[model samples]
Target: MASPILPGSGLGSGLDIGAIVTALVNADKSAKQTQIDAATKTNTLKISGVGSLKSALTAFQTAMNNLGNKTNPAFAGFTATSSKTDILTATSDSTAVAGNYSVVVNKLATGSKIASASFAGGAASAIPSGTLKISQNGTDYNVDIPANATLQTTRDAINKAQGANGISANIVTDSTGASRLVISSSKTGAGSDLSVSGIAGLEIDGTQLMGSSPAAGASGAVNGVAQNAELTIDGLAVTSKSNTVTGAVSGLTLNLVTVSPGTPPTPAIVGVEANTKGLQTSVQAFVDAYNTLKNTIDTLSKATPDEDGKLTVQAAFTGDALPRSMIADIRAQLTAPGAGGPLAVLSQLGVMTDRLTGNLTFDTAAFNKTMAQPGMTGQVQQLFTGTNDTNGLLARMSKAVDPYLKPMDSKSKGLLDQRLDSLIANTKTLTNQQLALDLRVANLTKTLTAKYNAMDLLVGQMKATANNITSFFASLNAQQSAK
Candidate 1:
């Protein structure tokens, strides 16, 4: 027997049946694989589905990053309203006015009788609270006691004080909505607080003092009149109960306590986490498909085999032709090295699959770092491009399979056209051959039939002759017996 070709090697072996069988098997397998690969490329299984998914994820991620780094003042919430004058102004300190203004009414009058009073020392409490009146110029004023007032009743009674006094007290609510009576001088300057005289039942800590200064143990009552408390604002004397002065400057709020407003407006919070979440979902899908393809490759490329020496693959996947090529395409893209390439190599991105376990683990921090680097995005595109597209993974694969696919170059000899020409020119060749075969079959059938018919006729004639002979012999035997 002639030498047989080895299956995998595709070379003839000196009729070694085993070698020949192996060669045939391997050759058939290789050819089948090539055909499968060609089909896969034409179908665009790996490129269209997985590649598009990854590209979309990458695009979204880039968008998110760009949004994150954007800085625009309009994005920060800032709205301000002012009354006529600019909220902020810059004037030389030396050229400002020195004079101060004040407001005072003459005919100060009060109610016939004082009801009650309170003087909150340093704390705000509802004890020792009452009502009183103050008569300034010709206007009569009744002071309402706040819920949280103390022995400051003498100060409260000053509401009933009648004279050329230049101070007035009123109750106002704070930002927290707490009511507190405030006492302020009609005059803003050195002597803005009260100077009690005509009013009785008034004293600052029990000692008599007339000016804008607070007196220790000022207390007293004269004809049901109360004393006054003193306070200062910006070196100008102004007084109030539970003072919570705000809006010291336009567009700015200031709590009377000990604090200054912080500078600039705090940036408004915006939600971009939704976009990141979407990107993550897309990326995860890419990861899953990639892993599936990787698993297919691992199964086909496994060194270990079963007792039948066949690779272990899912039952349906066994002998499936698509997986190996898919893996090769992926592996080629991931491992291919180029200067400043999207990843340089898969190892840089922690995308290398474990040889032993067939598992793909990632170093997220490393991957992120790489992505953040300059030119990383372009490199990433290159890695996914493979060899298929001018820029894709399948480009290389297509080139390799070029020999198996359509002809690389058309024949210049016009063989195809010539073949058609020959068929047209010799149309009778096929007819003649077909006619000859038909006539030969017909003649063979006729000859066989005629011979069989002639034999049947001969056998009939012989049988008739033998029957006659037998009848004659029987007659003769009977005559002899009679004689």
Candidate 2:
């Protein structure tokens, strides 16, 4: 900012030129300044209003997506149940057919466990110096034993070596203070059993047990063999390498936990059916979400006076049509029929809208009752999620709101973004105009100060001339009086 030029006071006329110049400059700049400030404030409020509306719409879109997700049970999926969950558990997806099957778990799949021969020196016993090979499923994992290595060191070496197929080793001491090296494998199956056979003092093949000495009878033996899980679904034999079984039924996964226990071996009844409760909850949540969005829009576009009518607060978007138009489009989608079906509308699914307030109300009891009807749950889910060819209700809502709520880009822009862009541009122009106004005010002040200084100088010169003439006349009169 350039400093203000101090105007000179008139010497002869005794006029305050600085005050006059200041008043004139203020009067000249005030109107333009008020106009710029008002425009800038209005534009800022409009930007803030559009930003808030866009955020609310984004939250609504997220809530809608949750209902349309296939894994969330709202999208016409299925739920599976086992009567004896302790013996078996089940899970199903949307493609699963509704049915009941008798599941008999004869045996659960198991991994391999082997205990090595007892060492006389316990952990301190010297292990044979050689390559120790642990084999499982045709993969031999070798552990090189250093010279003077003890049973403890051998176990450490086995653990440190990367066990290709999930191998672990530990030492178990017997009653006579003898340390037994026990090794295990996580691979499960009949043919995938584990065996150890590279060194003499540590040789095991399910039955071989290495004792204290080389010639002594070995005490090591296989504790458990890798075996496949045996189960029967509806008397149809099913064998699995792992307890967690899949593909035994269409779109169903069975987790075989334990064998069925009874005098005649009781079977667990596994059933698969549509998940209605989850879908109902999702639908209600969507209604609540819509209501929340509507409330925000109402607040932003509100045009009302206070109770006292003395002070009225101007809303952020009082005259803005963008918020209203965006809400209208979304409401139209919500009211539109969803494809050709008996359950094509939201009202049929118990989602109703208020006429006066534009808020949504969910009738959970009505929804549950409709879901209780035979095969109506799937139809309602389809109404929200839609099929391959037809657009669903949620899909339609996306189409309606995406144009306004999507992120701004080069090719296209959201409505809120466009409004904000124009507001920012206006603010930028106002800022430039304000600068120009200030420059003009400074120039005017400078010019007026110069003119006032020049006039004051001329008045001082004229007063000096008048004083000279008066002095000359007084001198002549004094001379005349002396004569």
Candidate 3:
């Protein structure tokens, strides 16, 4: 619909043809292009809004899931403490019962450490080559030593032999600058004692490896002695190869620090008790998470008030029913009575809703009073973690919100995810249409330019013919006047 493009109009019809053509083309495409731009902006806003809503919903679901988790200690509510922390300390899990334990550590477990006789050659001392047979707790390991191997090489070979050989070797330089191969048991216990043999020139003085000796096994020298940990728990004797003791107490692991070596057995008292403060903190976390979710939903679904006392609406989902309906469903689920339980409703557990704002508010004093009641903790747990037949408030709410916030899939795409996908598809379609429109506009511009250029050429030809006729008439007039 655009007019044809023209050259400098003053040389022909004295009209601005280029400006006229641009105006006509713009008028033809303005409405359709505006619609396309507006649609793209709207779809983009909708996608962003839906993404935010999904995030908020997922956070709320996580809070609900945590509260409903039966394995969480906060729900069962227990903590452990040690009276004599210097001697021992312990931690308790949910299964730990409230009780007092008397623990007496007689001796701490020790690992065996033995050293070979001092070599005057220091670390470079060449000992007998071949394999040294080492045994720990009846398990034998062969450490291969190369010909003329030094003390350091022998140590590295012994260490390289893996598995329950139960020994690690290292070289130690004494005060006289004499290096000795010191081998120690990898584990602590009386069963981890080490014995060595098969050094062709070396003498085994009991557990000590010497370059020369009075006689083999004649010197009964004890370089290191392995011992077990002895302890008493609740008047019962318990022994362990390591200081870390388990199975002595249910759901309690005692880390023995030092031995109590006196008579009359002054036992350390370890106590396990219910942790009410931890439970309160967890409940507060749930409340905070719920409030944050509520605020996000409200902001995304409602109009805002302007400084001029007018309500200016710009929410992408302002007219969307899904967000509002989801919020309503959540609120309804929160206030409903749980199935056949003492903590039938959230109000009974001290969680109340603000009527005006529809936000949840937790009352600490009331919650404490409820928890203090006999067997109320169990009832409270039941309210949040009911069976499938009798779904708890949190469980029900999570189920309701899940369908809307879950990811897109062939079998089951969530409501918000589906909406976003549709918007994207529409936007893509609009983009294709816009591209086609651009091609049409380009073709129209070319046609109009050619048309206008032909008109300008015709006008110039007419002007040239008129000029020639006028010149011819002037020449004739001049000749006649001269005659």
Ranking by TM-score: 2, 3, 1
Model 1 reaches what TM-score against the true structure? 0.26
* TM-score to true structure, per model: 0.26, 0.61, 0.58
Which tens-of-lDDT digit does each residue in 173-244 have in candidate 3? 756787666677768877676667788533333343232332222322244477889999988999999888
Query: Arrange candidates by lDDT, highest first: which order?
Result: 2, 3, 1
RMSD each, Å: 29.2, 8.2, 8.3
Between the candidate structures 1 and 2, which one is better when assessed by lDDT? 2
Predicted structure with the largest lDDT when compared to the true one: 2
Q: Runs in model 3 with CA error above 4 Å? A: 1-10, 66-72, 77-274, 305-313, 336-340, 386-395, 407-410, 462-483
Which regions in candidate 2 have their CA more than 4 angstroms from the true location? 1-12, 74-79, 82-101, 104-232, 236-277, 303-314, 388-390, 407-415, 466-483
Clashes of each: 66, 5, 0
Q: How well does candidate 2 match the true structure in TM-score terms?
A: 0.61
Measured with C-alpha atoms, the lDDT of residue 15 in candidate 2 is 92
Total colliding residue pairs, candidate 3:
0
- Top-TM-score candidate index: 2
